[model samples]
Target chain A: MSEKAPWITYRPELKVLDCTIRDGGLINNHQFTDEVVRAVYDTCIQAGIDYMEIGYKNSPRLFPKSEFGAWRHCDEDDLNRVVGGHDAEKTGLKLAAMADAEKSDWKVQVVPRSESVLDLIRVAFYAHQVSEAVEMINHFHDLGYETMANLMAVSNITETEIDTVLESIAPTPAGTMVIVDSFGHLYREQIDRLYKKYAAAMEGTGKEIGIHAHNNMQLAFANTIEAIILGSNRVDATMLGLGRGAGNCPMEILLGFLRNPKFSLRPVIKLLQDHIIPLRDTVEWGPLIPFNITGQLNLHPQHAIKYRKSETKDDFVKFYDELKSEI
Target chain B: MSEKAPWITYRPELKVLDCTIRDGGLINNHQFTDEVVRAVYDTCIQAGIDYMEIGYKNSPRLFPKSEFGAWRHCDEDDLNRVVGGHDAEKTGLKLAAMADAEKSDWKVQVVPRSESVLDLIRVAFYAHQVSEAVEMINHFHDLGYETMANLMAVSNITETEIDTVLESIAPTPAGTMVIVDSFGHLYREQIDRLYKKYAAAMEGTGKEIGIHAHNNMQLAFANTIEAIILGSNRVDATMLGLGRGAGNCPMEILLGFLRNPKFSLRPVIKLLQDHIIPLRDTVEWGPLIPFNITGQLNLHPQHAIKYRKSETKDDFVKFYDELKSEI
Candidate 1:
């Protein structure tokens, strides 16, 4: 991707937020060295990225590495080092990290103490764990960190389930509630409807709206574009399409589409050629045979991911048939 | 891209066209093997692609192998051999190809000869040479092919220049005049202004609007999306972003964003992994160094393409500075 682009019209409504070093770390055992993290962080900043989600800032001592949702490399000192060197744009240069709902005392750990460390502390919740996530969101608001309650595994979730969660979050003070396309299976109209519904529910709630997407269906980039176009303020991406399975939305592509000169592509490309590509040689994130099969069958993606990694091609076909027949 | 996609609501007003194999061949010397062409054609059909552009149809004698924009290996037989095998959909599958304004003689060579061969015959013109191009459009229209006048190098053209050409095209039975961003330079706002103006102007004369975009600044995809969102119907793309520098708009990505199951990504990705990726490894068609510099500096892309093949990176930077300083 070029930076000194000619007269091509850049969409002003589009905004790019890079989570390459952060979200991409999931595939690499959450292992990004200091230099690699610094390079990715600094390059993303140079690439005119709107926000840089450094990593999840769960209290490692409380949640421990053994627990799920405690995203690695998210201690205060590690985050401080990432966000420190960028003497860059003041506002919208947000630092985000995620916390789990089932575990972790967000009121005690995330609110008061983590304020100096994070600008935004996102509370990720399973369908049934909205209460805990809401508690954390409120605590972050009281502590003054821009907070978002992300509804995770939305594919498996029901509308009533989400509405129940929204109803609980209706009176919160944080910025927004994000539609996390954890499965990355959504198309344009689905996102449009979701954005509209969420926007309508949060209209007078004082919370802003955001969307985080995965690229399972390759709709992540376009879906994010649509969300922003329809008024969702924040869009998330990882460098070099890095994340679990097919990876998250690409930050570089988003920046170019966003057309803000503030976002550059060189650093992102440099990161790709230097770090992401090399990682691909080892870590491997993108369309897999099983994932591809699920995509072909038009079935739920989790089943595809699970079957592909475990079952033979014939077995996967049988599984797809069985699921279809059952449906 | 997957086929077992979750249910999505698509904007009813939107329709997506995929031209990957056809336009992508510009860089492949247009000599793609029969298997490659067949698979691409089949994939487009499976993907439920609205329009599938096959290749150029012109007099083989005039467009000798030495000249550019010749039909390559693409002739009437080629279109039938590839597209003829598919289970043609009532969704309206149209085969399209390009013809040059100054070259390909439409009077005796292309018009009557190609009517039975292809569904649409598009007359492509440079910014300064649109008047001459419109003549070819009239001939193709007379021959019973859906005729389109693609005003090429349009980023360099002003509205008055377009108007001058439009005057002649208005009288013809030309079905459409495509806004060709041949230079890959126009921004979103510029595209919006251009599309609205052209669509409105053409409505009076009664012509559908079409668009062709290049991705020098990575804005091609977004620009097309924006144009479609705003109302333009006809869109173009190539498989694997294959074309001159930085390639054309990506077909798979566009289809993924489109609000239709017809554009299901399974077959598209399968062909990509099977055919397009191999081609890309053997051939390069993305951001070269010069396109990168121009994209960064927000300069014109056509200049960058010529510069990339001719000059060194250092020289390109010097050239970019010279161009920028002048601007």
Candidate 2:
């Protein structure tokens, strides 16, 4: 490594996306108060963050808007109420919403970029959903919106499955293809191999590789750093890692590591202190033992998430034995 | 990057050292109870850990007995009380204690191997104390104890200083030379460089390079894995990352990552559930905001440790400003 290695100074092309509301909604059914969402939006602008993923754009029919919060739909009125018609040109902070394959009714829910506040539509899917994800990305692109094909749960997929997904999405209009460590099971070595594969597949597509890591094994930030070192420019983080089970990479730590002069850490710190930490009373996230077990076993966090709500939440030995027996 | 990487298979030469009691003792002034120590001792044996550092061997003159605990001195009587004369032959687990440079009266404290339970004497010192550390290692080696030269706070030292210290310890009788990230400030890129540097310096000496990482950046386990990938066999971890500030690499996660089948995660999980989690009420550790800031700035965690006790502990913006002004 040279004295001027990218780790020392950062890549200028790097873009950090704050997914506090989008992923964090998984724990609380997208029920974050408008006050919390607005605080996150303001923090993203002040902190010079490149993008802020507000929430998911899943179908109201599938999620039932009566039960889920307004963010589950990310309606035009609900988004405007929180961000007041976010102007990406003025703030330099593009707004994004994750649209999961099969879960989202993109044909009707995803309006043209000119009509919505969202600048990007992140198409999340598993290996089997790659074909639909490609169509979603192209559709969103034709609607004049940026797009990313986030392949979720890549750790659980086979090498051939990953290759096929990459090949299918390689020719799409997605501006970025992300290596989503949905289970937080990947180590830096695996991140290195996956990054190389993604980079090779998107060699001439001009599409950047992104990283969206979970903190189940406490490697989210570390894995994100590893991805950045290997030239993954689009990265995802959340305030205080307030996402789903075991959260996402923390935005504060990620900003501290990135040497981009445009990024500021104070606003993020303030938001974490004032807004995110208070949510701990009703929301539980971080690399707890249950999540760590799931991450280590390369299993979905749903089991650990359910077990955390049980009376025997602290019975790690029982959890481990049960998880292992299932394998 | 190969299919059969070292990460996929076990390295028989690799040795894991559980520093739970020793490092975790810092938060409580080496005040762990007999039950806690005994539990950790038994866990190490059942988990098939190679070595367990019980505590520091500093002199009573430097640290008064009343102010500290028995682990600070690690007297034979206390060792016997907890472990019942830890027999390395029978348990396949070696007991060790850290003796800090200039603080330990090794001449009077470190008894001969035949007269005590300690199998290894870890000599921890700063760059300026390398000469003293070398002499201490030699003194302990003559007494028939295996030894390690733990260069503390390598992240704060200059390259030339590191080279000088490595040169001085190369000819010593120490069995391992540890890259101690005392401040928890190193990243994987830095770990790669430091590992290569230490490996080259220790070449042909038949000495192994070790890693003793702190988790201020939540990178302890990740960095430890990086070192292991680069052939650092002697690794240090504590249960639940229970150490001074942000703690050390977590033993449970480390055991989970290592491919060695001899190491059992069940013992570690049980220990965490039964012994470590209960201590959280009295002892606070982990990568909180204060510690994370200090780690990112490459500063000692003492300031963060002190700030964590203040009335405005959660006022991260104020803390960040004050810390930055000092820098």
Candidate 3:
């Protein structure tokens, strides 16, 4: 809430994190071809993006290697294949991968940054898993990688629960705490309240607030912008909003709003045109009615995702009635 | 700017206006079947919506009777054909129609309310047409109809020009002054700025500020919510966002957000499922890449609309290059 308009000034500390492959992987089981992945990597560098979340580092047992792509594990070799090596001087863009608190075997899967090309580790956790997420953040930090603790599905969490989690994570080694709208159900008012809470909690901890929004309500970009206006430093986006069930905020829209001259819109638009848009033929994502319904109800989008893949995609009333009954 | 969250409370004075026919008509030349139009009218009544703008009052000589449907002129007979003469006591839903300042023949085309079923005359004008729009508002007021002077394409207007226009229209007896994002280019900051200017300029005039957002940048619903939070009581929406290029704010989303007990989401969802979704096969609308480009550039979506009609609909890069050259 600066008296001067947020758009008029540029915050140099603001970092744009490209989650195209990481989030978009949810649609196609992280099976993006090497060519497409390389194109996104090159685009991120050209677009002057600060960080690129390559993919997740989940347990191979839970998500089989045969079913999912190499990104699900994000081994040292796969990281080396996409990005040459861990040479910060060679490529200005920092590489990151997510590790879910409960699903990821972080102690063994995530190697030291000196032995890998990844420079950061993003730890995603539900409200109940904050303690485990903090431990993951510590492990990643110990291995010489910048860390982010993403608390997912925050809209369903009570205010007291959120406050407790924020207070618990305040002293952690994590550099940033992300406001993840996992259900894409949050409005600007909710974002405002959550941001104020996060900012107040992390006041002297040298931590920043990051935003990762989904487009379930088609408010992904708007919600991201709201976070930025409230001084959240880290922002997540995907090319053409390619992700699971209502996608992520489109990179082109985010780049268009951020007047920081370093961020170029052309490269993101090119990647979207050449790679992401065509993926829509095979990958089913975006703000369909079922997704909208689930987002509004603050329920998991998996039910809607399942309904969308079925013949009942257009039977919005039927799906709505079922959802209401569930509530 | 309120310290308290707006969503936690409901504003009883807030009025929801359904413009599905009036705005959606732009996509299909207002050529909707009687069944579809009646469905939306009934849905609005059942949903407890305050206003339903049936269609335009433009001069048939200009728009051509052969090219468009009867809604284009909104004759009394046509109004009767839709709602059977607008029994406000029974339905509690007011009927309204739009009239473009230049395209409409306000001198003769707009019949007295005593002779028509319409209860409101919404005068849509550009920034340069404020004086003419004020005159039209006065004319509508003299005819005993509630009036709204909608200043269209507001994203392209200068602050000084908007201030002048607001000052000029403040005393015109217009019940509402709408901030119409015709290009669908505005962000929440712009909407907030415009709303504040309109509110400040019309202080003590008893004129409510309205929002008519297009979904070019996919911010229509977010922008509408922003307007409401800023205390803009008059809101306009369309079912499934079925307007011209990117469409208007979806009625279901708006109704879902408004916590008013009277406004039901089930009816709006039924309308979307049974009526609006089917129109997509015959009519092309919603946020295509080209519309996003034009919206960001503050250009009209007409060129993008024409491009979409061509075989190069998916050639987003080509459209982007052309738009950049124009800029």
Candidate 4:
């Protein structure tokens, strides 16, 4: 009971990262308007959010600029155009961008941090991509950028695989190792074990454990709360949970739960009201039945995302039976 | 770790009650069409759910029939009209209805078990209404029906008040005592303490502990899982979380989490598709920002509900600031 007092007395080291555009781009091919991005940027500063992940840094060679939006590549000029070369020292808010393993051209795409406004390069990879993720983290560090290793889809991996991945990346220059519930299938119990595992592996390494949850079963924010209770310092959320299938944790709820007086919920609410909510007509995300099914079965949200676009999107019984048959 | 193994091992005693129409009625003045009610009824039977709460059994004098729908008063003819006099023994799905402590004329409205199709009568009351709740439970018991005492808004009450209420109701003939998070303000820690306290108080009385959570903080299903982990057998959920304000724990997610072999997700999914989903145009429910704000402040959702209907419903920044000022 005493150990759980952190629920009331929040840890000062807790850092909130808003990845509204970064993760939400998965639904719309990183096509958010610059106005929306700027709104989120301003919200992060006003809400006292520690970081705001603008978008992905995947290579244009893999994702053509003509097909994808400027955010997909995060070219320095495009970033600067939207955020006006955001200064972390002035706003007290850092910038981040996800670099997917194998998809990103780290050699040429990631220039020295001095030339870029981005402060962090988050490396997202599967358990099998640990080696590449480590290399990316080390390279990003040398380039003078904060780095995080996000091991995605941990729900589908075994404890041994996680342990192996954790061990491989434990000594990296990455400042944080995130438990990314990419499938959104984990409950609090799984979160408890995973948080403890990450904490144990990173013990005395000066690296923080972060939680990047998806809201397939609508447990993203709840699981994030569970991780925070277990001493996770780095938390990821988005405005109105506007991410991929079912989206990420809502920044409004996350800020409301954290007792840090520095954090304000009004700005996030304003962002949701002014920017995120209006995106409902063009892009669809939330705990829809299809996403919930995928989350329950520990399956990737691609199938659900595709199903939602089909003519018979609401045929949930058919969706359930078909998914069950595959299982 | 062994105790938490229930996450995998099925608990046969665990009873899932679908209170879709019962709780959802709060949002629309109990105006759900008979077709929707019948659809939910059929789904409950096909899904092998243990119990289904049709609606409240409040007095017509307090809530006039002209203003409220049939389900609000839950007259026997109305219940029979929709469910065709549902038989618990034949369908294997028991029918239940909630009767508020002061709002109900239980002595007159509650027919004998032999005369009615309802099997369980849930008595809902605040901490101050414990004696009335206990009396209602006893009266319902004498009429030959299973009874449950729901202590509503436990989040607003002190631990001492909860202890007093638990002690007062421990000796009653009620078969279950529920921790009702009316405001949806409680986190996992509060759920843990409340569950333990309820379990201890009801230890020798053979009364099961139940959880009835709201989704204002989007923690309904997660908190329900937490309570279930702590040994709660009776659980309450609704289809697509359709209820007052932010809604209740979603029945679809709850069934998915429970390892019980009898429960089926397809029927619930079908119900969501065929019936509940269509209600979105007329009624609004889910974890909206206004409800989340009220939940954070530990206030009744009536304010948020009213705000959601106003001309400036999407003005969330103003809502948060005004609510915070009151606090």
Rank by DockQ, descending?
2, 4, 3, 1
In model 4, which runs have C-alpha deviations exceeding 4 angstroms? A1-5, B1-6
Docking tier of model 1: it is incorrect
lDDT by residue for model 4 over A201-309, one digit each (tens)? 9998999999999999999999998988888889999989998999989898989888889998887888888888999989999988899999989999999998988
Of the candidates numbered 2 and 3, which has the greater TM-score value? 2
Best of the candidates, TM-score: 2
Please give the lDDT score at residue A33 for candidate 4.
90
Ranked by TM-score from best down, the candidates are 2, 4, 3, 1
- Please write out the lDDT profile of model 3 over residues A53-110, one tens digit for every residue: 9999998999999899988889888888877755555767999999998899999998
TM-score of each: 0.76, 0.99, 0.97, 0.98
Q: Give each model's whole-structure lDDT.
A: 0.65, 0.93, 0.90, 0.91
Q: Find the 10 residues in a row with the least total lDDT in model 2 chain A.
A: A1-10
Per-residue alpha-carbon lDDT of model 3 for B1-327, expressed as tens digits? 336766756889999999999999998899999999999999999999999999999999999989999889998888887777678768889999999988998889888888887899999999899889989999999999999989988888788999999989988899999999999998888888888989999999999999999999899999999999989999999998999899999888888788889899998889888888899899998887888888888899898999988887878888888889878
Residue B198 lDDT in model 4? 95
Binned by DockQ into CAPRI classes (incorrect, acceptable, medium, high), candidate 4 is: high
Worst 10 residues of 4 chain A by lDDT: A1-10
Candidate number with the higher lDDT (1 or 2): 2
Evaluate model 3: give its TM-score: 0.97
